[model samples]
Target: MGAVNLYVTEQYLLLKTVDTLQQKYGFRTLFISDARDEFLLEKYDRRINHVICIRRKTFDWSNQLKQDIDSYLRKFYQQPQLFRGKETRFSIVYVSNLKPVDSWEHLSKTMRLKGRKNATVTTYFVDEYEGLEELGKLTNTIDKNDNWKMEALPPISEQERQMVYLEQKIVAIHQHNQRKFEEIFQFGKTKWTFVLIIINLIVFFLMETQGSSTNSLHLIDWGAKYNYAISEGEIWRFLTSMFLHIGIFHLMMNMIALYFLGEITEKIYGSKRFLFIYFLAGFTGGIASYATNDAVAAGASGAIFGLFGALLFFGLHYKELFFQTMGRSLLIIIGINIVFGLAVPQIDNGAHIGGLIGGFIASQIIHLPKKTEGTKQVVAIIGLITLMSAMFLYGSQQTSASENPQTMAAIAQEYVESERYAELIDWSTDRIDQGIEHEFVYFYRAVAYLETDRLDAAEDDLFRSIEINEDFAEAHYNLSVISERENEIGMALEHVRKAIELQPANEQFKQYEKELSQKSTSG
Candidate 1:
């Protein structure tokens, strides 16, 4: 009877400690048995990704305790789906009422030899055991006598009744956790995700109708991100380019990613918040791309990555729930995509990373639906504004044409279209001096020199352009013209033959080749 009473007191204390650990210390229920004799609880410090495990059981021998600990460690390693960390730092807390017959020194040595480098096991015995005082301090069970409750308890089997109560408490905790998880996603409806998808599809089809979406000139006309245009104060391209795409395949991929990511983000953040996050992410992503790249870029990749950032923010608030639901898979997918982007030279990873970080910052600015952190949100908003401003200022200051040939080429093309030969000559010369020794740059300058009647300079530049790019049909054709002017029919025929071979479908090359052949035959 006295043993039964002690068991009852210990069970009650165990239940109270479990409740306190969950409610106050933020521990999550990991495992619970129907018999309620044993259970496992875990707590994670989300900030550091550290984990603590608490196990409850009765062990009659030190070896039994050691065996259980070893088994649990095996299970932990085997079930990678249960957690995501490269090297998890695990601290296992073992709680029991019955003391082992032997000292734990041998078991401790065994654990040290076999356990993971960062794993450790600590034992605490309750109810008339040596570790009771230390356990009391940890669980807030000191100086509190729950033994009095056993006397008022029903005259039923004490252990069975306590087990039943413990099971009920565990069930209630699970129910509470489920409710909280459900509540977080219930605040918003998914509207903007679908709407954005429609908008992107519409824009893609419209862009195709205007001309080919793959055409750089057409893309620029339809508001793709062109660095030279942006540098010329067309800042609105940053926002508009997100709605554009480089090709049908690029559009399709982005829309697919957006459909899935947008739905979840919209449902979590609501339409207004989703819009804020999307645009902010896209804008920052564009700026980041602008700062690092001079390519004519377009897509919703930045905004899609921003959605990734938004979910990351959600995880920060509800770490345990996030891991339980989509954390592992999300992290794996993000890792794979990032690695793929790095390996592929054409991928705009700058935009991806920028949007990810921007989306996180944007989420911080708006916070959750009903939650408000006044100072934190304000700081986030200011910080984002300052960061974008700095990036924009830095990008604008990078004026060396040698550094961005695509932008320089675009500028040269603009001059060519407007018949500004003098300006083209001066601009190309400046670029050439700055080490911008591209085939197109030399060809454009040669054309300008030819227009100004500088035949020798034009011929020299044409030869240099062909030397840089052997497949430069335009340079070859122009060199043939210089040879023809000097009455060198054989050299002119040779140059025109190469031009015609390079561009078989060009009527101009064919016509020039025919003229050069006739001149050679007449000579």
Candidate 2:
């Protein structure tokens, strides 16, 4: 025969029916419900099917009732006589107070006595207020089917109830512990604190290795070399030199400042974003060092300046919490650093200014994942490209001019001062043949050539230095003195006028100008 089917209003009622049906008829049953009833159904059945909840106003009674009744009849009544006795073949029943169709009571009574012999279906209504009375009615109605049977069922055991309660408790405890662990880790993981510790360790190592008892590295000395190289066109040294310190105090102070500022900034921006800002600051410091000539620079003060820039940007961008906490202090720190960088003599103030500007620009550019993608990244790329191009052009010009005669003359002077005139002469002669155009180099080489009595080479370099920089007082003065030595008064007088015009206030030029005027008047 076909399987038995049962439906109920509540999950607990469904579970109770399933238990009774399994004991009395050895039939497995399924439970189904909406969210309100499904939770309890799932706790009991584990494999219960969940359906969407239908409210009284929205429920379509026609479709739902038809579907439920059709499912029941298909499972229980659509079978041959071999499975269900011939008397019971094609028989089905439903037990509920919910009427499946209009005039269900009249139809139930009519089907019992007059419907097709064994092919009839019966529905028994159970009164919600009277449970046993309803069951009696259902049993009596199904008795028309010759194979119908009924029996009492056992109640659920207490042991099964207690085991289900304990399992729920264990699941709740596990969920609580997992939430607590996540909260603890989230509180401990901060980027600034971690970065501060690393910077402190590095500073400690650098100080231990380089510090001495009396002569210590000073920021001024480091700043001086830092400034000079950058001013003279050695720009790459900017990033490298910021880390270098002249003494213990220099390293200690810078490290302390970095620790505080970097920590604060990192806390505001996250580790990844903070790192980008820091490195970009360092790169800007290099650019600043290159732009100024008199200032020597060193230290992470440039990057510190950038942190202030970030503070300003972030404060303005996020106004609620960060701005109120950090805005004032950042402004003060930046102001103090500016005063120090600018007022200190022998300090590459240019580098400090450049670094500050660079830091500000870098801060503007380093996309901090705050809100929108800021224009800082686009600006930074363009600025970096422009600076690199300028450096490249400057380097190329210097390299191409290295072969000029005036450049050779300057090189020979160094050799002469070091007492290597013989080597200088050989080098000068070799360079002369290369056809350099710098007047100073040619003049110096000519002098070296003259020292070995190569007078022609000395005159050529002196003339070239004059040609390259007409107002080159040194070259003209040298040429004039050389001419006087050779008793070439006319040549001496002519070059002296050019030298005096270039540097009228220069004492040597003044004396030459006066001497030449006297000689001209006397002649």
Where does candidate 1 clash, by residue pair?
none
The TM-scores, one per candidate, come to 0.64, 0.37
lDDT of the structure predicted as candidate 1: 0.75
Q: Which residue runs of candidate 2 sit more than 4 Å off their true CA positions?
A: 1-236, 294-296, 320-323, 374-376, 387-523
Candidate 2 lDDT: 0.50
lDDT of 1 by residue, 1-523 (tens): 4766656656665665566566666677766666554556665453323344455567778888878777877777775544544334444555555668778645533133144554444444544355455444443321143221212334437556766676587769877876776678766788888888888889989988877787766687889887766877899999999999888889888988898888878878888999999999999999988877778888999989999999999999877777766788888888988999899978988888889989999999998777889999999999999989887877776644435666566666767776779988987887677676789889989988887889899999998998899999989899989888888888888898898899989999898888878877877
Tens digits of lDDT, candidate 2, 161-215: 5334533443344356446434422322356545654654575465446542112
Predictions in order: lDDT: 0.75, 0.50
Top candidate on lDDT is 1
